[model samples]
Target: MTANTHDRGAPAAPARRSGLGVALFLEATERFSFYGMLSILLVYLLDVRGLAAPRANLFVGSFNALALVSTLLGSRLGGVVLGPARTVLYGCAIQFMALVLLGLSVMWPVLFLPAAAAVAVTNGLTRTNMAVLILRHAGGGRSADGLATLYTFAVNLGAMFSFLLVPWIGRRHGYALAFGACAAGLFMGAAAALLNRRALAGGASGGTARAVPRAVAETGLAIVSYWVVLNFPAGGHWIFWLVTSAIPVFWAWAWRNATPAERPGIAICLILVAEAMFYGMFDEQTTSTFVLYALHDLNRQFSVAGVTLFELDAPQIVAINAGLTMLLGPVFVVLYRLVDARFGTVALSVKYVCGSVFIVIGFLVLCLDTAGGAPGLRAPWGMFGAYAALSVAGLIMNGLGLSVVTTYLPARMRTMSVAVYYISTGLAMYGGSVLANAMGIGRLHAATPIPESLSTFHALFRGFTLLAACGAGGIVLLLPVLRRLERRAG
Candidate 1:
């Protein structure tokens, strides 16, 4: 494990595992509440609220970007004055209130935008606090990977509930009811943190300034490109369930060794080319093209709940991936541990690559199912296969891969580094939306029936296939550079 001056004055471990468990529970609840809201957001805005697709997507992306910034700012404040635990509690309160307001916004309507932004702020603060708590609980490096994977599992579980339950319920009751559910979740999450406050605040006493050299800072800053490449695809996946987003994030991180500045420019250029290909290939499943196909070309049903409940549209189908992850999360973790034990450190890169490959294959499966319009009939089940692959792939890609990045990055750059990592993801989401818009998928109005969207699906998939190819090529080109850098750094 690597060391930083920050570890020097850290205190002794808490006397009881119960205390740590309480903290973990609080953190996990917070993740659940936040992701629960996120799981339903895009569909809510674009479908239920009667907003334009592009505008809705743009709003969601902008809000997420703001939240990312808020997290960085909140982390600094938590580190210095309020401390991580207290800041987390504060964030919880904000989240609770924001969710309540969001529910109210369903009635007021004009307040929805602000309510969404407030949720972002709450998440920013909450995530920062949870990060600090996680590191503290792990006692530096001991359980870093396990903790990260667990946190992600909790998030995916929360998302799954929101995706599966909320959508089904919302179809009958209305979007407002869904927001109310999220509000309840936020309150529970906040209450959990409040209950565990005493335990989380027990450690870490004094804060001391440490000197960091400019050269090292520069090296860290320069690494943002790699971070961006890694996060872009993941972000797309999360925001839109653009499962293809996994391609860039996983490939970049797996090929991290090749990212050092010592590598030749031509080699790096080739790597970027491949990354672009992978990203393109991966994007098809999430774009409006997919949405169009699901509504128009595929067989769909409406629920007989008397309220006109739509049954399993494309967005909802993508949302089901969260459920798949939740069910399989623990199993994946155990399998991952076995692999890690067998392969040792190389397991990290292996998981990263495997995750990306899974995502690529998922996209390929999607292309095959819909490519020639088999029977010229819509099969929602085909999309289900793609989403299932994505869910499992995301477990390997983001869940395991993020652990490696968080642990491997130097300490001084940790928070900033994560911020950069997320920023790339944010940008890619916005970029994918724009690209989808260019292909005419983003302009679809609620009144537009599904049958008109099949071509859009085909176009989006073709683009995604190209992106995946590029990302794969990027990994190959960066191989020599990665080998050299690994030898030097490792």
Candidate 2:
């Protein structure tokens, strides 16, 4: 569908919170479908389609970048044509269609890249639109925490469901059936969003949906810059988890005291850059690199309801990480709240640093699993540790950072700001994948003489650790610039 061409109209003021439960429910389900498919895409390409692992990785990376770019287009379309509710509906419809196409790709096997791209765009749009809705309804410290919890809960629940469901389906039936099930879930989510139309679009308030070309252009430029800078560190970090994406988060926090004129753009840039690094690291660990590790090195198993169904493969094992997060997001939220109370204001910098520490520890354990001769060295349970880190980081960044960034921006620029942050991550995700593939060329692939030991993987980890440390340092250095910008805006 093309961008909406409806007359610009004022948004309806939010009067009720009726369908929030349903909305959150649908969001969770959709997230499950998206990530479930994502966790398995590289395997699908390599195992099912006969594509080389490196090529498959690049395809997935390209898809991620495109999807991130689509969010900008989706937000613009939402503003001009369908308004907020309709925009969300459009994204849902796209998601449904994408899922169906993905199922077909599994069945026919030629539609992989196209199907993947469609799904990516759907996810990007849905995330941005849903976020806009939540931001419109809430603000302030606790409110931000609440919204982040709700958002994280929904996503983690979806991830949790996918981890269990996809493994069972793919193991018992096949890839095609597994993808088809995901498509059905997507349709269900779309249906739920359609039922709650009013609440979704109520954020339009009284302000008409005027296309502010200058504002859009300015926001777009800032996003492009943020993405370019953000992706370099993110790409390096994603290949290995030695480093943390915490610096970007701290940089965003540093903007709290900046001038209004500049705060939104600068904050958005830093948040997106940081988040891009965070997600790049998280996704690569669970999806691409980790999946390969499990298949090649680990003893895979499928234990369902206390019964061991079969030895699950690498792609399926990745679901464990998603599942754990789905189960733990709410618990983390409660913990965050308690911690925030003790820490007083609980600045973004604090959360960023804490989250990065989790990542560092997770990787440290993984390093031990690889180098310390841990049991299951071939089929390490280190992934469970990786998931734990992802959950903690998600709570801090998605829960805490988003709230700060959204509240810190002016209303007129909020959506654009969110979009900017999103696109930055998109670039980081794609770039990181590309770099990983390149790094693996003569290093980790099937052809390379199996490294004599775990030394190769250790080297990868050390490289990433150095990158993360550098990015974190950059955050410190950039603090003055962010503060200066924010003060000027004020």
Name the candidate that leads on lDDT: 2
User: Whole-model Cα lDDT per candidate?
Assistant: 0.56, 0.59
Model 2, range 400-469, lDDT digits (tens) per residue?
5456555455455456556656666666666667656555522555543334325555555555556656
Off by over 4 Å in 1: 1-16, 139-142, 205-297, 300-315, 373-377, 447-451
lDDT for each residue of candidate 1 in 210-237, tens digit (9 for 90 to 100): 3113322432332232234223423433
What's the C-alpha lDDT at position 188 in model 1?
74
Q: How many pairs of residues in model 1 come into backbone collision?
A: 25
Model 1, residue 99: C-alpha shift (Å): 1.1
lDDT of 1 at 219: 22
